[model samples]
Target: MRRIRIKLNRIPSLPERRRVGRKIMADLGIKLQMGWNPFTENIAPKAYALMFETLDKFLAVKTKDNRPDTVRGYTSYVKLFKKWLLEHGFDETSYVCSFTESDAIDFMDDRDLAVSARTFNNSILFFRVLFNWMIERKYIKDNPFMAVKRKPKRLTQKIRRLFTPEEFNELIIWLEANNVPYLVMALMCYCCFIRPKELSMLRCRDIDLDNQLIRISASIAKNEKDYTRTIPDSMMKYVRKLDLSNPGHYLFGDHPMYDFSPGTKKASSRRFASYWSYVVRPALGFPKELQFYSLKDTGITNMVNSGVPLTSVQQQADHSSLAITSIYIGKTDRASEALKAVDIID
Candidate 1:
């Protein structure tokens, strides 16, 4: 029998201390015989896994359970931290409790983590999550990243304005003339209001031309939930041009340039951005603020301006609430024209 005697002073206000004890006791399945001894006869200290061993265990739990993209992201963060750990001469056999708040701060301040505010913030969040997982399993007493501050994160890329009709038409003409591979993909981003990542995961089978609905799979979806997006009436003629007869084939994927054939393999989600950055942006002399994602904004604006119901817009965008749809709706293009009728300062 293992006996633990702790006179925890001011435990009423020290909820963290109480929480730690509760977590460890619950995780080890130790029903306290004495009501004070958290470590029951079941738990063996010798059987406890080391730091590296725990990492392997964490990965084992995630590899089969989590999404591939999620797993990859977590793995990359681990690799970076592992590299930092190795550089600082951290022993792989050290217990999770060996890591301190200062150590976490140093890791956060590491030059490699200075990529962007979002990346740095995400790294902190990842560590917080990892340490919390460790704490739950009785590997650590506290989360080190809890002391590490997150930098202000603004998604600069996503803060986009709507595209003008003139620029939009010009780009389409250029795309058609140049026989660009991203032609269909670019149109889908606007017409279907699909994000690049979502479009990259699209298969011919996912699209129902008969019903004019496109199914967003749970695996590749941003929200990790299944969604159905409508193909607007105007887009039907354009969508029908594609050979979506091959149910197994990718709608916009690895295929010959200008061929517009169903591809056997999935294409990179970054292709749209790549083309916009190198080809389209340069040729059109578009400003830095005019990103490729602006099409989704522009399209949504047009849909609302054309008298599409707000509820329908909310559903089509796959937003959780109508408020999010309203945020994107912003000041519509026709708002200026409509405001002209109302004379101010009468």
Candidate 2:
């Protein structure tokens, strides 16, 4: 029997106790045991420690079992969701019981500011995922999201704003003068339809300059699948101009890029996104409807306008399904007025 006495004189708070218990469980061979009261007895201590250790185990399993970047995203979103839940009077154990569709909708309604349906839907998805995880472990009886109705049309609407050629030129020039590595990263989003998370893990070894292709390993992609995408030839010259002397180096190394928050090892997509929200985007005098992802939309639009087939563009964009590719092409078609059509209109 291992017995070490800790004095009640310096007893920590509940959260701190949980932390210390987790550390003890991790460092030593001790396990948590909980009976009643939750503040006394070996059973309660062991159970308390087990709960936290299980969360840690779930976290580790997620790290190795899922894509690295996805794990990071889940951790961030889950942590935020947990904080939001606690603030709203929903305890951790409450998640183990399936939440009603109304419960979720009510939660969204409680937000003082009106959030876009997509944004609100995303939060619902986080809870749905959490509950699904709970169900898988027999923590919950069933999934509640299965019954939630689809969000309204107003909330589901997408704002499609392709950058005008003039705006695109000005945006590029501004970034170049202002020194933002995000400029090149943004160009990659346009040129290749590469997601921001994919770009974050890009390494020197993935580029094949001779073939003008970038191999996005399944390891870093959102879809848990590997794909090789062709880079737009228009971007080739500048890509060649980039310093690739250090093989296997990050394309965007730590530099004096515009408003780069220092000490972050990799450029966070969220932080890069803030640049659009605050700086380079505002300088161009674009409206709120115009978005950063619209660069990818612009690329697709450019392809269709240049007479590239939808199927061909789909392959280049590395979309898994034809339906998704069709949506991209269709959305771009709506902006055809923004592009010049040489079809000889009378």
The prediction achieving the highest TM-score against the true structure is 1
Q: Distance from true position, residue 61, model 1, in Å? A: 1.4
Q: Which stretches of candidate 2 lie above 4 Å from their native place?
A: 1-64, 77-115, 142-150, 259-265, 328-346
RMSD of 2: 9.4
Q: Please report, as a residue range, the 10-residue window in candidate 2 with the lowest summed lDDT.
A: 42-51
True-vs-predicted CA distance for residue 323, candidate 1, Å: 1.4
Q: After superposition, how far is residue 271 of candidate 1 from its true place, in Å?
A: 3.3
TM-score, candidate 2, is 0.68
Tens digits of per-residue lDDT, candidate 2, 1-346, equal 5564432223357776666555544533432433223234322122222232345456777888776666877787667655666776665433232245565566556542456777767756765776566556654455556565557778678975888788888888887667445666778888789988777677766778999888998778777689888877777765765666666676655444444322234566776677787876688888887788889888877876677887888887877776876665545424456455556767
C-alpha local distance difference test of each model: 0.72, 0.65
How many residue-pair clashes does candidate 1 contain?
A: 0
**Alpha-carbon runs more than 4 Å astray in model 1:** 1-49, 111-113, 153-159, 224-226, 256-260, 332-335, 344-346
